[model samples]
Target: MKAHKSKTLIVYSFLLLFCSCGLFIDKDCFDSNEYKFYLPFTLSPAQDTFHINDTIRLRADFSHELFDSITLKYYKVENEPLMCYFYFFRIDTTPTPHYTNQFSIEVDTGNVIISPDPETALRYIVYEYDKSRYVFSVKFIPHQRGVFLFGFGSEPQQHVNFQKKCPGELMDIYFTTNDGVDNNFYMMAQSPDSSMNAVPQHGFNRSGSYCFRVVE
Candidate 1:
């Protein structure tokens, strides 16, 4: 009886040791911090007034940092770290294009180097990228005269101001982060960009076209 009790005590002690060391307990350090995802990207040709028929380029090189920051903040010292982020802040890779007819976008294959191929689905434009890794560069041509709202789920947001080639500087063109779908939003503006009613493009999904404009 004494020997049996000693063996049971040893087993219990071992279990307790493992549990205290977190070997048998929660080993993954959870990351609830959302601010680490707020990596702002810069828009090429940062302008207060981008004109029609202009090629606007977008580039950002903080994807690796965005992931690493969370990894470091949440689970750097853990034996087996399971890092989880709440929101995604990269290019929105919608199966269907989520852009306005005012501008057509494409990856700058010449200036930008995408290795192992970036992501693009059937009938999807190059704008639908997985992540703007390293130097993610893309160019968009403005086809019409109005403001263009960036698509929802599109993150690492970029803020741009547009001024049409009009007489008085009354803020005719603009770029925004919110598409105003279901009243969900990321960044909020002061007066709000004019809601350019959603519409279907040549051969794209209308609902995914989360961009709007104010043409006067």
Candidate 2:
């Protein structure tokens, strides 16, 4: 009986040691600090104003980042009929026609030598109503039309490398109909060259003249 009790105690000790070691290993593997890298830059529209059937381009300049690898994800507003075609441009060169039209798409911006010129910039275009919005529904009414609101999502939130370390921001671009008023609109006046980095404001309607009027 003494020997059996000793064996049981030895087994319990081994089990306790195994569990403690496993807990430590998991803690080391999943340290949140290790994955706390900030996003390189913020996303904005190359041209602020957009209209029905207009091809909008969003640009992000990462020419000053040290990291070469990045993962970017795009999301759509919930319960909204809005859709966008995403395209990626490596340099000033024209991006390929390949595009993903969906509620969301992911892109891996591979490593590239950073440069100061706009050529080194990455461009994303959101195309809405390739043919006509009316084609979707014969009863489509002008006033009932919706606007296009699309933006980017980053793994680690974007941040500006300032003295105070400002967190990076994202602004959704709106493509309002010619006659319809979009109260959610805001002016994206910040030029790509501006030193102040933040997502453009929301809630100011973009002028109608900047948008394309589609005629069916």
TM-score of 2: 0.26
Predictions: Cα RMSD each: 15.8, 18.2
lDDT tens digits by residue: candidate 2, 16-134: 99987676443423322121222122222233333443433222222212221222322222222222222221111122121122112233331122223444232232222222211
Q: Candidate 1 lDDT (Cα, whole model)?
A: 0.33
Rate residue 16 of model 1 by lDDT. 88
Q: How does residue 125 of candidate 1 score in lDDT?
A: 19
What local lDDT score does residue 24 receive in model 2, on the 0 to 100 scale?
Answer: 48
Give one clash count per candidate, in the order shown.
Answer: 1, 4
Residue-level lDDT tens digits of model 1 in 1-216 = 999999999999999887776643223322222222222334445443456677765543433333223334421111111121111111222222323444566776423222232232112212222343333456767665544434312223122111111122111111222121321222212113322212223111212322322233
